[model samples]
Target: MPVLQTVTRETFWTIGPVGEAAFYYLAAVAILVFLYGVYARISEYAAAPADPFDRLDDLPGRVARATRLLLSNEAQFDRDTYAGVMHTFLVWGFLTLLIGTTILAIDMDIWTKLLGQPSFFVGRFYLSYSLVMDALGLLFVVGVGMALWRRYGVRESRLWGKHTDLEDDAFVWTLFALGVGGYVVEALRILGTGFPDFETVSFVGYALALLGQEAGISPATAETVYAAVWWSHSLLALGFVALLPYAKPVHMLTSMANIVTRDEQAGKRLPGVPADLPPDEIGTGSVDDFTWRERLDQDACTTCGRCSSVCPANEVGRNLDPRDVILDLKAYREERAAGEAEEVPIVADGGESVIDAESMHACLSCMACMDACPVDIEHVKQFTGMNRRLTESGEMDPHVQDAMMNVFQQGNVFGDPARKRPEWTDELEFEVPDAREEDVDLLWYVGDYPSYDERNERVAQSLARIFEAAGVSYGILYEDEQHDGNDVRRVGEEGLYEMLVEDNAAAFADAQFDEIVCTDPHSYNTFTHEYPEMAEEFDYPVSHYTEVVERLVREGQLPLSPALGQTVTYHDPCHLGRMNDVYEAPRDLVRSTGATLAEMPRNRADSFCCGGGGGGVWTEVEEERKPSEERLREAVEDTDGAVEQFVVACPMCTTMFEDGRKTGGYEEDLEIVDLTELLVEAMEAAAIDGADDTGRTGAAAD
Candidate 1:
């Protein structure tokens, strides 16, 4: 019922003369080792090629944000709730314990020695500090216990891979030992010193001490046990610090630095290949090719495996393992740094190289891994850089090459005639103006799929209808428009992507539009996210069609009444949902159709990819089942048989689901349609029903 406020306590309560002197010797050695480890790791980062953090602006803001994120681990908690709670407890506990030790050191070495100044760790402050520190130590143990359970209890956990790795095991337990051992020293000290008044403050220690008394241990023996345990705890702590340079446990020190200095780029920014890559440079051939931030990313990994758990490639049984890639890179880099002559394990890890053409081709660039990663390692960026070099070497996936060739031959990836892009527009009841022909409010960037794919062309037409209904003045580039280069850069053909960016920028310049609106999320992501530097003068706002439709419906510009009343499910396109944060718009548009929106388990930021992003649609993944089919099955399962439609916004997603329906044999079970199609149907139905109501009311009155 009462809180233990504070009490006076000696700083070095248990240590004998030898033990007291031994502490300084061990600490000095630990300090030297820690400095060496920090320096060596710093040098490794300094030598890296890309330092994304260097480009960050708003220093005060970045620092303040970093402080909050690092202290609270809120970013991790936002997505991974259970683990976040565990980690938050562990991190804060360790910090509080460290503060306790520092304050004790100050009491002994600084405050007590200062003339006329009383030590802060006395009376109420000491009792409260001791109690909080004891509680935090228990908290630390609980967190570590949960981590152990998670790593071992779950059969298919990503953490098992790291735990099973023989090399990291010792380091893992060493840190674990340091965390759990401190309490042991405290218990013995309390039993020997007979600190009954302080029992409430260090209750965990008191409990253990009580057990020792019941066992009939004498005070003299308890003193001996206390000294022995104290020395062991101190030595282990020193050893843990010393082992930082030799083990992955260094993440405890480096992850915070990496978190604070993390880059400004997120899901929106893909790694761009500079035209000026060194003539002899082989991308990711060694760790040096990566930037300091990326190399620092290696040290930042906690072996939590959150990234791999959400990775679509791994989910679909692809050879690419996001977690393994980082671990392999760290191991190989360390080997190389140690001057071993063996070829770097980076290009090939085990039987398969994560950087190999086969593995590299499997990535969807969906940002699922990045979204799930607590440490914020740029897995996609690193993989894409390697894939790009592989493409330059003519080692790209064959299906992807065909698509790239299509871009070269035609302005789009479909290799269809440029004139056919706008042919679908002829069927529209109203004229969709040409941006190149006249000034318009929005320039519609008809990407490769909607312009040519028969399935998506209809969706594009439906979207145009919605625009017309909203009284939007929109136009298209028609034959002049080119691909937005999102997937091109993702597929690692930076050279070709640049050509596409330049061509599209030229067409955009020629088009007299106030802003850019696109049906394809890939184009929307690139034009707004990736191409501002390319088109500086044409600084028009780039937005996806769902955003436009959602706004129109919200503003009463597009009247809609739910007609079908069918239960609908929405599939978030990776580019649109996770990458661009456009989850709400499509959902809004779907609900406006009077359709009940059923949600699959993995929606919003956790949305499953349709398996078309990062040119996955063009690549031949060797999985028995594609992600899109699995996603379709998930939608079906979530709806419990009532869902009438699966609504999507991205054209690539439309095509992926269409093909998947046939391949997965779900053609009769579900239907895939665009969000715009639903909105259009709802708007037209509202119009017809309004007119019918007017006529019926007049007839009744007459």
Candidate 2:
């Protein structure tokens, strides 16, 4: 009766009217629900204040970045190898299954119906497709199994029950059930139709068919059972689609969107707040004030704890965990939307705001969380925005409030006299040029800490000696230098930060110098990255001291011994290394010191913070174990007791670790020397080796 003598195949393969109608109905409903979920979220996001999504500029570049983060899973895998591979399997399996479903649609709806073909999807090509799909389906099964094991089986990890609750558990189980159900429906189909050559390619299906055969299920009876399963599997698939909006699965879409739309400066760029704001608009007071991208950050979080895990504050048991702050904001947004929020500062009885004031102020603003986040969620910006709200509401932390007033009154964080700035230079051997008096090749922006802190003053003097021996005509702002405001802005003292920036920019404009150089990374980042817009006259090639010293060494201006026996480890300043990407310059400077370089477990972009960033040097953290101490332990262990010198390039880093070695009881073995000090020693040695009585090099003699 059949036109083709086949044991198993499908043109519509006798899919009865009832089965066909049910499948189409469920599918249509699934499509409608999925579309509705997507459209509603998109509409809500689009309604946020205009970013004028530049749809065309570097679109290909944007797509490539998305493909790396999403399609390639670069960020995910780069952090956690096992979890990355596990996630990859799930992603590939899902994509393959979706493709198979699409192909089936094309074969039936277009090939057979539209073209009136005898039918394809039947021979070797079909067999290969079937085999591939079955293997991939098994891959999906394995992935789900692994997820269950990782989520429930593993007891030590924080992966499952710690942050995720019963709802998350339900989501994973539902997903696995749907995946496993697919094969049950397939195996039943193959048995119901009388096994054939193509069915042999479906290994999972064929194996299950053998079990059914042992049970003595006749082909006709098998068909009857398949009819029931066919509807059940279809309904589950439909339900999975319908659950997209209300579950953790929603990160699938949101995370991808967040990565692709990541701002040009890689999530470090924060939108500048207007100086003049209506009373209510002073800060990001509520969800309505958040830009759409910020809202997307709340939705996109994978709750993986990568951000929270790396946060210095969180690591030290401080009140803030960046990840929880985002989650709290999301919950707070929901509560407000439902008109459930009823209290000032949103502490309804107690929990008014998503993140309370103490936790909000505890953030280091170190950007560690930003670097750790795979999805490019800017936790620092959001935390700082909330800090803005707290500062304006007069609920600012007492210490930060004191720091702000100190900056206003003394033009420095320490509340020391402004005249104390140039005092460090008086200790330098050579007469240090003051830019206000004479034109110089470089204007050294002596930072607050470098100018006044006793330990940091020696580091600043080392910089001056290196510059002098290198024959660079550099000068300092001396007493004219204002507090650079990098930390001030980070502290959310925007009013004082603006005043400082304006004052400092005016100082720069008045000074005569070819380039700007800073001994402190914080001031360097602020001058080079943050101060340009406020003062157009502040346009100069600003550089950090390490970079300038490295350049001098490269040009043979600063000759080095190039052969030493000390094992040295360089600590990358978060601002110098991660923020500005100056990892190699410092390392190269260390290399020229002729010391054997020993890296700690985490170095460069992955370098652990020294707990002195984000105004951290000024903020008092009362943790039993400090982050710098942790780093010192790492350095001691990583070098296996061989390291004699722990070199640092930033003043904050020198101060942090120099203090840490003592407080952490590591001072016995560790000596934290400035990178500039190392360079100065090496140059002096090279000068000794090459000089006649005059103490000048061959190049200088010419």
Candidate 3:
């Protein structure tokens, strides 16, 4: 039998007797460099203060959610699947390797004393553990190999293509080679030095030793090769550590840290601005206005394109790319950090270009990117803040200025006078409240579309009939309600949104209503989540029409009769579903009407936008063809011929669907109705008398 070679006895002095001294000095220098880089970056982020840390006390909950995200299937279908998997492997494997190296750093006698003799059970267990770690390290190398190949060989890989410069590719390749070479060296050491006297841990290394023997290489030669490889591996790993904070690989540490510090309820809309905040101090007007946490998010972006992949605006050929927004912000910050004084130019594929224009304006503010992001970066809120900057700073575009003026002067995007708001309700018999009067049970905020558009007026009429039939005490604002300014804010008019919120809040402050409900999801979202600061001052709850309807149905106050057995698919309005998580209430209301709900594959939080959100309903896209036409085709396909009707709860969705129905030539086959309209039909069938039912003297006998 071949004599077992020992690693301790096979040492060679390549850099003289001072080699160990040189290694220690080098390691210290690398650590200092890395620490300095981290300190600088963190200080830059700390310059901006964020929202008060309400989440700091929720550490356990944050960890639990993060663990679920890591272990669950939420990340399986991501565009960067391979990259993510490889990154995971590298993280876990490298950690284990660090433990192994620490063990090697200590005296063998000390390790034996702590773990017991090699023949003892605890020692054997550790040996098995190390062997398993070796296997994991090999697996990690294979994953890295796949990543390298994808980066270099696959031309279409978004991570590696022309979008990535050579520096990025070099960074990735160096990290890959370092990880692979480190493990290879360890395996060789195990084979050449069987002095540790553990068979299982040395399994692969022993096998390699036999192959070397068969190749006629002497035992001493193999040992020497192992030492060289080991040194090279250690040196390369040290280099990687020093380079980390400056490269994209910094995400390895920061992503995990960000995850650890992630908000327990990440996508929730933050409480609305405080009503007491002085109007002069209320708006975010520049990059200087971003909070620390927000800036951390800007730095934490991995640029994986997950946001872009799911962006409705980008998919529909709009100039906005959520990923690019983050990249630009980060790049700009980095330039600022490097003492660059020149303003960064904003460029996209289209002729559309503007310097200092908030990238937020181009965004639909849909929140799809937040849903799709693996890191849970809050793009919607950040975008909103940017828009706040442009508007509050008085640096808005001419078009945005015009739109805001229309909303402020006319109380509608169409620039129609506020007097026309009550024109739609003229044909109705019941009395609607002024909304600015004393409190009532409910306040109906009739948005511009239902008030002005002829086709949408029918929806308003349907809502009035349903309210009357449900026996619910409700009253509309009629001429008293304003536009609410969701579109104004989305179109980069923060001043207008602020003006609208303050105006609406004042109207509600004097009113006696316990809750405010609206037919338009845009108005509903702005009221429920955005206007809370103002609403809280008035002590009122802002709810969507669907939420109120769902509440009524659950309380057994509204008797719904199943008359329309038509199969219908519910389209999620971006504002209602993604912005406020009002997905279930609308569907529940539809189900209450006895319609079989056919859900689109993309429903709820992941639902595709109707191309009518974020003020797109008012602004013309000037496209060769309208985006709603495509969305209608998708909705029609999702319906699967179950019935003729498509249910919508948003005025914007109604308009988009109607246009889609016309453009797709499905006018003869399909009809779109708001959820309120469907509920009215059910109410009419039930014959229940509501508080305002003037025509009906008595409830029909059941």
Task: Indicate the residue-level lDDT of 686 in model 2.
Answer: 78
Of the candidates shown, which would achieve the greatest TM-score relative to the real structure? 1
lDDT (Cα, tens digit) per residue for candidate 1, span 197-237? 76667888888778878899777788877767777878887
Locate the minimum summed-lDDT window of 10 residues in model 2: 343-352
Cα deviation at 654, candidate 2, in Å, is 1.7
Please state the error at residue 662 of candidate 1 in Å: 1.6
Candidate 3 residue 75 Cα shift, in angstroms, is 5.2
Q: Residue-wise lDDT of candidate 2 within 1-702, one digit each (tens)?
A: 142234336633346877687677878888888889888888888887654234336878877888776657667676578777777778788888989988888888788889887556666667778888889888878888888887778842545323567777777787798788888777777887777755888899889887888899877887777766766777777888877875688888898788887765532334457767764466677678777878889999888788777777787777777887788777677677679975335311135555677776677666878888888887877777776776677777677778788888998878899888888877666789888888999998888888888988888888888887888898888777878888777767777777887888888788888899998888878777777766677789999988888898899888788756688898988888888889999998888878889998788878888988766777677779888898898899876548888998888888889889989999888789988888877877777766654555555788
lDDT of 3 by residue, 481-510 (tens): 788777676655655677787777776666
Off by over 4 Å in 2: 1-8, 11-15, 51-57, 110-120, 160-163, 207-222, 340-351, 691-702
Model 3 lDDT at residue 274: 53
Instruction: Indicate the residue-level lDDT of 234 in model 2.
Output: 76
TM-score-sorted candidate list, best first? 1, 2, 3
What TM-score would you give candidate 2 relative to the actual structure? 0.92
- The stretch of ten residues in a row with the least summed lDDT in candidate 3 is 1-10
Pairs of colliding residues, candidate 2: 346-352, 346-353, 347-352, 348-352
